[model samples]
Target: MILTVISAWRSLLAVAGLSLTVEGLYYLIRYLKRFRERRPPQVLFFPAPVTCVRPLLLSSPGHCNCSRSHRESALSCLTRLLLSARRSLDVCVFTISSVELSSSVLAVHGRGVRVRVITDSDYMALAGSQVGAFRRAGIEVRHDQDANYMHHKFAVIDGLILITGSLNWSAQGIFGNKENVIIIKSTDVVKEFIEEFERLWNEYDPSNYSFSPKS
Candidate 1:
């Protein structure tokens, strides 16, 4: 009788242990699932030392049979870079008249990415300029109000890639005139450009604009 009681107690204890183990595992799995759901998805960018240059010299008009070759054009390269922004896009340029580039900016903005544009105040009012369109689209745009030109032709994409050079985001700059664009993925270089962009963005804020009294 005593032996039977001991065996029964052991069996109960063993069953309780198994139940606790199963419960622990169930809660562990729940915790892991919730943690994964809370974490943001990781995005991998191209490794550093990745650089691209544009305004690839085009073959003589008749000699170039394939229009697809123009995909390497500076405009196309810039547009592709702009479209690659998953988090943010900072554009600081003297002027923006290229419809393709503007469209890319708008597209990224529509994707819920933060888009900020800084351009020359004077040029923003000029005809055929896309700065106005950017504003109408509800994207934040800032421009230098002083007499000096806000002559910057650089864009920091996702704070990872830096696109800069003599190439203006304009039809003439990309297609007609000789121009150059450099796309770099260096962390150090991109950090500097990001700082500059933030500084200009703050300096050009409407709240910081000053008006001189008329004499």
Candidate 2:
């Protein structure tokens, strides 16, 4: 009888342990789900201002053959700025024909960064335009639908840094022309650009697009 009693107790203990294990696992899974749901979106932070200028003038004396070190070109500066984005990149440009800059944008998008492009509808279909490639990669792109052109050239990185100026984000703008790019880290300036981007983004929404003649 005692042996049977002990056997019964052992069976009960094993079942109890398994029940406890299963219950623990269930709670763990529930907690994980809740944590994931409650987690906030990630954002990259910048404490101080950072500025990058483009088409750095040669530091060599008399702009001569003096082998003095020079700052990065506009293309390199812009590419680096794009690559530095961690959370979001909002590009509001007149056109994008620079292969290198487009590649950098694609790289960031591939890495899970939220990217949005707003460009002139006409230019988007031009030869060598990367807008189609962007759409194929599942990036959201918007364009002005009106007769007037969307001639803005700027980008906001992580809602913190603002990149703007005469740079067109094209090979011609970066290398061929006397272009300038100013990267500003001031939040006030960034805020203005962000507002403009949001306004244009909403205005250019496909749903709101109208090619009909305006009264």
Candidate 3:
């Protein structure tokens, strides 16, 4: 009888041990499934009004009474932005002829800032267009592949600062025309302009390109 009791107790203990092992395995499987099924994090953006705002630098030629030197012109502001860029510069102007501005852009390009220039198919042949100077400097330049007129006058610097206005990058626009060049310091605004710039840049198609502004 005692032997029988001992055998029964051994069987009970074995069954209890097996049950504990099975329970542990079941809980481990449940934990793994929950870990694998959890959703990934979502990306969010703040609205414009609540989004970050930076300094607003303006260059209204009509508002200034400064000397008629490159140092005092609206182009100086653009040159400064080119000099300040550490990463990238996207320039979409109708025409850029000022040698000072071109030299500044070339300096940054030499320093390894990715610089892209887009101009109008018709305007690049203007007597004062600096398209040749840009090409000579080994800068990547493109124009509207279509005759629809890529008359965009804006630039995004370092993915943060945005420069846009009626100001063209020419001696006339700087010295002759009344222009308003706004230097906006908003990441969100810059992103929007950059996105649009990229779209135009890709569509213009520089693969089989040439600079033949129609006479």
Enumerate clash totals for all models, in the order shown.
0, 0, 0
The alpha-carbon deviation from the true structure for residue 116 of candidate 1, after best TM-score superposition, in angstroms, is: 0.3
| Full-model lDDT for every candidate | 0.77, 0.78, 0.70
- What lDDT score goes with residue 13 in model 3? 99
Per-candidate RMSD, Å: 10.5, 12.6, 13.6
**Which 10 successive residues of model 3 have the least lDDT summed?**
45-54
- Give lDDT for model 2: 0.78
- Rank order (by lDDT, best first): 2, 1, 3
Candidate 2 structure quality by residue, lDDT tens digits, 7-103: 9999999999999999999999999986765454322222112222222221222333434334444455566678888999999999998776888
Model 1 misplacement above 4 A: 1-71, 212-215
Please report the TM-score between candidate 3 and the true structure: 0.62
lDDT of 3 by residue, 1-215 (tens): 99999999999999999999999999999978765543332121111111110111222223334443323333444566667778998889887886656667777787889999988988898887778877887888888866677877887888877888776766666656666676776555677998999888887777656556647
- Give residue 54's error in model 2 in angstroms: 18
- Candidate 1 vs candidate 3: which has greater lDDT? 1
Q: How accurate is candidate 3 locally (lDDT)?
A: 0.70
Q: What's the TM for model 1?
A: 0.66
Q: Point to the candidate with the largest lDDT.
A: 2
Two-way TM-score contest, 1 vs 2, winner = 1
